[model samples]
Target: MRQLFGFLLLFATAAPLSAAEIHDDIDADTGWQVITAQAGQTKIRVVPAAGFNVFSIEHAGRELLKTPPALADLPGVSYGVPLLYPSPNRVRNAQFTFDGKTYHFDANDGTNFIHGLVHNVPWTVRRTEVDAHQAVIEAELVFAPGTKHYAAFPLEHTLRVTVTVRPEGVSWKYEVDNTHGKSKVPFGFALHPWILYQGERKNTFLTIPATQWMEAENLLPTGKLVDLEGTPFDARAAKSLEGFVIDDVYSGMQSDHPTVADFRDEGIQLSLDASDDFTHLVVYTPENKNWFCVENQTCSTDAHNLYQQGLKAESHLLVAEPGETLSGTVNYRIRDARGHKFSRWEKAIRKFEAQDRQHPPAAGGTLFVGSSSIRFWDLPKYFPDRPVVNHGFGGSQMIDSLYFADRIVLPYQPRTIVVYAGDNDIAGGQSPETVAKDFQRFARKIHAALPETKIVYIAIKPSLRRWNLYEQMAKANDLIAAFAETDERITYADIATPMLNEQGTPKPELFIKDGLHLSPAGYELWTSVIEPLLPRAN
Candidate 1:
């Protein structure tokens, strides 16, 4: 039997030419880097030497951020969204006592250490890529026990940061891991973003969702918390920064809550949503400078001194103990007053929510998710004795799992989960390596919250229609299989194997009429292979 074909590549505006791109370059003198990411009318540029922070964000040939003139000469932390590692703000006398040892930092901010060591240092660009949606760059910097980074901070740690620039917005993620094998390290972080607007202070409005402001002496918190009420610093709601000097550190954001600091000026709204890992917000509107800073912080200024003074109530510090890693995210989403193509998937996502509400699946089942193969699975016939929930959507990619994982998979709370994707991704021309990394990211997001749960990834299978991509699919499966070996919670089910015959060709009888989706016979083949990989139903 033969089936008709419908390829979306003909009429859809999603041309391969419109995809985003990232270019890596190096400076001649400083040996620094200039990484540029471009997508449609939206463009982003960064200097990895400058803490890998975004140096420019342009939309329709207009710069959205006001870049300082001395960007190349001045300290990076003073401009752009600087990666303030180790600590966010100023530390008194460039010194702090951690675990009964007084460590001294490089005194660049007069007598205090303004930003951590990586702001002016170099970082290695591990990976950079541009897909249909966004351009991403992953960079890392490490400090050894005898290096200057350890000389100042006295802790051996590594920081991996990733920056993503899409048409909708830009986001930055931080992962700080303790590398000393059995030791512990304490650290704090803040991303200092000085956003620029076109209008005057009175015309630009700023709002920060914070409840309390910490009173500080000489830029260090004095262990006193004052209510953010009745003062010029009360930016709980949108207010203009007119006629008042501004420099403040505020806390009291709810955990896991996204605290949005909205800045509207020149008919454009730049929304900075800091995750709960960031407990403090610093707003600096200097009377002399035209730009304003909306900083997301993880702790108070001079947190070590506050901790030494027994002010545990006001200080929030992060620790990297053995077998433990810490991560935080800051999403800077943008909304243009003019029309833009930002919410193309809103309808589909909304419909998904509506469907979930209308018919919710039972919790604590073996969850099957991803592309049409999983969607078209005859779960009852395959796994009749086990409890199973299938939430597979249309011909989806790896990112779709990340998009709807919280809504669908998280609610089920399955004892064991299985994902099948990357087929469409490879068919759409994404590299095998990129597909593997995307699957890794998806699994990490799940296990971050559900540590005890086991996750299984079904290797992208070969079908008759898309057999041209079988090699790439096999490579993707190989990479993911290797990654699964590194994580104890993940299991890689090599289902792509038996689907191929002895001649290394796809089994045509396994495919449906379209020669793409799986047939009942194909589902049977999967059942025979994947059942033994799953845990026995309790």
Candidate 2:
């Protein structure tokens, strides 16, 4: 299906556009397939013959991966990004019993088989394409009889990997097809990417978004989970890697937050967002080393043996029955710390676009856009009979709404638009003036593209947690309301004024336990204030 879409995109433009390009230069003995995107702002180098490994990923003239000094050293060096599959990290004694069969592997790492086969082997290039939006390279390896490593594992399966480079960032999709095999196959997948520190190594901040750590005695999980509270591997928040030496597997990964590496000195942030299949993460920050490894694994180390030992949940061993295709994606996004605010919301926007394609909302409906306040609102419950389209992405500010307006708002051609943002902007340290100015730009952009559309700006609400910022919120609301009065098509819904108590404090019952998000009563009150401004049900 992706290949078909790429083929369709090939004829999308009448004229040639230098958006993204794919080049294959294997005759030079380099055997590199390079894909460049965003007008050469980002480049990804893949060697199809060398395990289909993405050896180099350069962005903005900076190398993100740790590459060898010489090209000849690439094949032997363990640097760059390599996919560890079938079994990741290590297998106990290079042997594991799965189902009723026992298999053995080469002890590549001292009495244990580390990082399964196919990482350094040749793979067939299934497809490569360059479209206006992105460039893609798809490679596959058939792990059946006659294959190099098939005699050891003997699993008749096909592993397909697709790497895509776009303006936003790079994404990898790994898939395993076990349709031909009659037996249930057990496997694990992981990506070992040696990341180079962009600036000072000690100043590099890492956020793992994990709560539990796998207790390992010999570089392998011991089937025991430990809390990372006081351990040296507790990096749930953005913590500096100074004086920290860790090479451990972490569990209880939070799906909402991505594993991030913030280069504060370089003003660059590298984030890795993986699918739910990736429930475990391995962080390896060696002492006296300029590079660290943040590996996203589908299962814990020695998952097969651990699963056989009845530690199913902790092992996360994936079983593929007949005709099952196990697949997952991991996206690598790069953005500047000072700018590219909307890049973080690219996944959310893509999800919305995909939803639009499947079950599109009706045109000329009342559209709502904003931060978590709008995102958490039960639009259908509040306005049961009205036609409303909600595009509320949490953790968004006024500028995000304005930036994505063309994609989500204008395309809907809604008759009325309700916006409830700027709460997070002030909380995030942006000034009230900047928020109001952003809203002003948002209004102008909306009015320019959608002249007759009625825009109802929901005043930033007052919360108990941020009661101190009420003055700033009120100032922004006043600026927006005053601006709305100048425009006949705009309406400023002053929900903030009504949410306050007689003593001018935020009502405690109006907020949830967090004292920030709205309670049911608070949303009811907001509905009473903004429902009247919405388009009436016909």
Candidate 3:
């Protein structure tokens, strides 16, 4: 039986996989296919289908991964690609012992047992025809007590795997039943798939609405939860996965249905909707690898230990009674954004514009908008003698100021407008020309609406840190000053000039540890610059 299983594995690994035989049902109520393979410039595409949306995983015009096409193909390999599993990388030891029994498993990374045994093993496939456009594949794997390497598990179980492929995307369903009469079983399971052929690493992004992350000690979960706020663990934004080496588990994920792992450059997006059972996700990106893995899981890596420690919740565990079964599903889709970029600036701009239209800026109060440096400023206390309205948001750019001008600048309708912005624009990748143009547009709009309001443009400060961009910032300040000079109502305030050291750069005393932002001394310098310009108190 062992020899037969070995022969079956060899055949499964070496069988000829047909790419051409894969039929395309484009008109069968499934969504549009956004090809990303060599033909599509590796972008994502989204199509709407009947009863569901079809998302295809493509790079250029080549298809890399898709849902199984039939119920009979339940564990079917994608284009005969090796179904990469357990954990893609090294597992510390090729054996994990539990309940006084040691189980020795196959090792791939010299240290870790990977992808579990199910991935490389072949299963009997039974296909069911559902019209010409749809089909279902059902595959089953039964493990008897004391079967070769699985002897440590010592429990009879039947695992049924189902795959449904339509024109839109693929859906996978797994049902596990304990056949051991009156005997309880202890086991852990996970699904692993490696997505490869991704284009430029810097251009690819992974987003998961996760609130907490699990820190690892040598790739083993530590059973501790860490907040995602203010850390690189936060993938709320589609940040570049380049230079990131992540092999961590994340729990407490936002219950947002259908979480997405979008790879725009590859024109592929893998979505997991295990909202009912799989609440945790593990994202793995090894340095210099061509692919990444987004594994939907019910628990962490060391779930058994976690459960023993009372760190695992009941929702994360899969327990079965006599004749009881556990089942769940994961769906994958593909989409293309057509080069449309996603940024915090764009969202902030849209929100500001909406608020501006609803409650236009008061026309003249001082507008202090920029990065964290500006937001930290206590406007009311700083300018107590003057009637000032604060419109400052931390970590904002000049473009944000322009987009949110009505909310931050124009609403106060004061006699003068003091503008403090631009630092974050430079950090956010805007050139001096871009920053100047945005500022110019904002000033023109304000002036057009309130001709009598005086415009005061504050100079972008040089931070003791982030000196690399100092020259470009200086150039930006110069352009702003030149632009302000073109109008009678516009005035330039050179706060940066006085704050600089004898060497004509920021002094360390004026900055915080990050160096890009300011210290109390920095705010004091700003106060000195504005104190003389404020109008007398009433």
Instruction: Score every model by TM-score.
Output: 0.58, 0.61, 0.47
TM-score, model 1 to reference: 0.58
2 or 3, greater by TM-score: 2
lDDT score, residue 75, model 1? Answer: 47
Clash pairs, model 2 backbone: none
lDDT tens string, model 2, 138-233? 889998889777887798888899999875678889998988877787999898999999778877999889979999988989999999899877
Q: By lDDT, who's the top model here?
A: 2
Cα deviation of 347, candidate 1, in Å: 15
By lDDT: ranked, best first: 2, 1, 3
Instruction: Give the top-scoring candidate (TM-score).
Output: 2
Candidates' C-alpha lDDT: 0.73, 0.82, 0.57
- Model 1 lDDT tens row, 445-513: 677546677999999988889888788888999999999999988999987889889998889899878
Worst 10-residue lDDT window for candidate 2 reads 1-10
Off by over 4 Å in 3: 1-61, 65-112, 179-181, 266-268, 338-538
